[model samples]
Target: MNTMVWKVDKYVDNLENNPQVVDAANFLRKNEVVALPTETVYGLGGNAESDEAVAKIYVAKGRPGDNPLIIHIAEREQLKQFAAEVPALAETLMDAFWPGPLTIIFKRKEGVLSEKATAGLATVAVRMPDHPVALALLKSCGLPIAAPSANSSGKPSPTKAEHVLDDLNGKIAGVLDGGVTGVGVESTVVDCTEMIPVILRPGGVTKEQLEAVVGEVREDAALTDEAAQPKAPGMKYRHYAPNAPLFMVSGTAGFLQRLVEEKRSEGLRVGLLTTEENVSGYDADLVLACGRRGELETVAAALYDTLRRFNQENVDIIFSEIFPNTGVGHAIMNRLQKAAGNKLISE
Candidate 1:
């Protein structure tokens, strides 16, 4: 199928006055897929209640059946329609961070959401997106929308609509051009189904922020082969990868410089994603500095875009410096390590 692309200037602005959202809504109601931007990442969306529409998302992205999808809603009140019970804590967290980058996993409302939407799991991940275009689309459709990052599975998630066209061009129904995604990463996925909240995937919402709201929040242990059966999105899989091999730079700046030197000495074509402070001393064919230390939000916005840049440049490998594991940095590192494929911790 030929994927139609609609370029909406200032997406939120256009959404306020444009009638195209109504057409998009009608298309979704008929079980079609639409690529829309979010604060975190562009999403390939479908009617969450339609098994056929949800199945199309899996087929479009080649996502695994076991990896669940997140349902996007227009408002907090809509949460009750899909979730069997929204725990008081979950409600509090939602009130604190909804219309932003936080996903809460709650017991499914059974028939309200399709089994395909939740990967047949009893718990469903849901969030009210902060992006106006996304919310407008949902409100127009008046149904829960099941969506995953709008990129082919295992590739870096697209933060821009053009990236969606590059990866999912002919595979989807249409693309809503909403410019660049603000957060440029996925949502922080917290499973409230458990007695104590567990972070299934880290993104724009940090563990610290969640804990600030609910006292204590925990991250799942590092993924294992058996653990790849994701109870929520991005939990258990080789996701957010670029075409080129990616490596994480651990230890001090001097140590990272030596490591890059060694790789370059081996005559390898390397791309570096490090802080601006570290880039001055590194010798690489391509170097993309996210930002200076403590400026993780900048890094988050450029993360996927940098990966796509390296992939386009045909680099053999990418070496990225690790960020301090706090705030958005945690989510950035989560995506970087997954892209790197293996962990290299320095003592």
Candidate 2:
């Protein structure tokens, strides 16, 4: 299959009718997949209403069929077609963060979205991306596009077009290169089918932000319970991992530095993933400073690529300092913990 790669602008230039955009949208209409940029991350997209189309996405990414995919829409009015009933909280959140990076799971309208897209469940995950290219693609395609992270399953999500090509160059139809995505992660998933909203996954949207609108929001227990069934995309697998083993340590900078040195003395090539403030404190063979302390958004942006870099350098093991559990920090730690496969050590 010839994978078409096209460069798109941040804003549309008659995008709905652009030949290149049309070609990409045409590919999607024919029950094929396209990797398109969103504010959060690149998604390998297929028409949500078609089983064959959604099936192609899972095959391309080697994603588990049981793990649900998020459907992307062009506007809020599209919700009525897919959802059985949109709750009051869903309306409030849509008003607050649609065309951004928030995903809300709602009860499905019978025979609406394909069963394959919903993972045989009664609910479906959906979001409207903020990127012009993404909105243009969805609008041109004229259908809800069910997409999962474009990377091969259980690996890091793509925040750039190059990252999509790195993992899935020929596996799908094409990629719409809208340059580097802004949020650098996936959407925050809120399950609104219940009486009270429960967060299945944390991403670009923070819990505090959700609470501000909904009054009170709870997190899914499946995030930490290994024996439990996964309710969202990232919870079921060892995701966002690189080739090298990653370990998370919760201790003072001194303790982290000593641990790296101890590993180095054992003839192991160690990689330290730390903050900018403590970059000089680490004595590892390789150090990747994610970002400054207290700026969790910056840290989120660099975390995945840093893991990929350690792989390129062929480090034996990587050590990372954990982040705070509030705001965007929660999402950062969630990805790192999955990348490390929950291999955490305390003070």
Candidate 3:
């Protein structure tokens, strides 16, 4: 497939009427997948109502069919079209975090969306992105779009359009580049099917923030227990991984440096994924700093891009510094742990 690139200004007004967006929407209406920007990450989107379109999304990303995709919408009224029930807490959360980086899973109305998009589950994950270009595309498409991270499955999610082209060029229809996304990671996925909302995946919207909006938010057991079946998009898979084996280090900077030296002694091209404060402290083939430790938000934004950098450098092994699991740090550590495949070394 010839993947066309359509560059549009991120801040342009009346994007729904923009010719570039209209072209992208036309592709989506024809059941072709297109990569569009969201506040969180670039998403490979297709018509959620068409099985053919949804299947193309899975094929483009090589994503497992069983893994559900989140449905993106432009208006809140669209929620009533597909969702059978939206719990009170979900409505409250939508008011607080919709148009941002929070995905809410609700009991789905049968025969509304493609079963393939929801992985045949009884619930559907949905979110309204805050990005104007994304909203314009959604409005133009005028369909519930089932979308997943626009990258090869099990790899780092794309924060920039260039990253999407790097992973998915020639595989999908086209890319509507609206510049870099704000939230580096995917959206926070919350299951509102149950009485008390449960968090299935941590992302831009922290658990603390969710708890602040809707009290007593519970985390899905699948987050920690591999045996449990994950009901959300990002929960079941080992994602955001680099080409090299990454190990999470839990200890002082000196201890991490010692391990890096040992790997270098073995003639391995070692790479260190650390913070700006510790970048100068490490001596390795590649020492990339992913934002500062003091601000976890910056780390979340840079997490995937840094992992992608390791792949570009072709490092033999990677040693990553662990972060405090608080606020956005929870999301930062989650992606890091997934990229490292839970390989943690303590000091």
Scanning candidate 2 in windows of ten residues, the lowest lDDT window is 225-234
lDDT of 2 by residue, 75-123 (tens): 8899999899998889999999987999999999889889999989888
Candidate 2 error regions (>4 Å)? none
Error of 3 at 170 (Å): 0.5
Give the Cα lDDT of each candidate.
0.83, 0.88, 0.92
In model 2, state the lDDT of residue 285. 87
- What is the per-residue lDDT of model 1 for residues 61-151, given as tens digits with 9 covering 90 to 100? 9988877889999977887787899898888888799889988889877788889888788888888888888888888888899999999
Per-residue C-alpha lDDT of model 3 across residues 60-156, encoded as one tens digit per residue: 9999888999999999999999999878888999999988999999989999899999999988999999999999999998999998999999999
TM-score of each: 0.93, 0.96, 0.98
Q: Which candidate is the best by lDDT?
A: 3
Residue 73's C-alpha lDDT in candidate 1? 90
For model 1, the stretches where C-alpha displacement exceeds 4 angstroms are 11-17, 223-233, 345-347
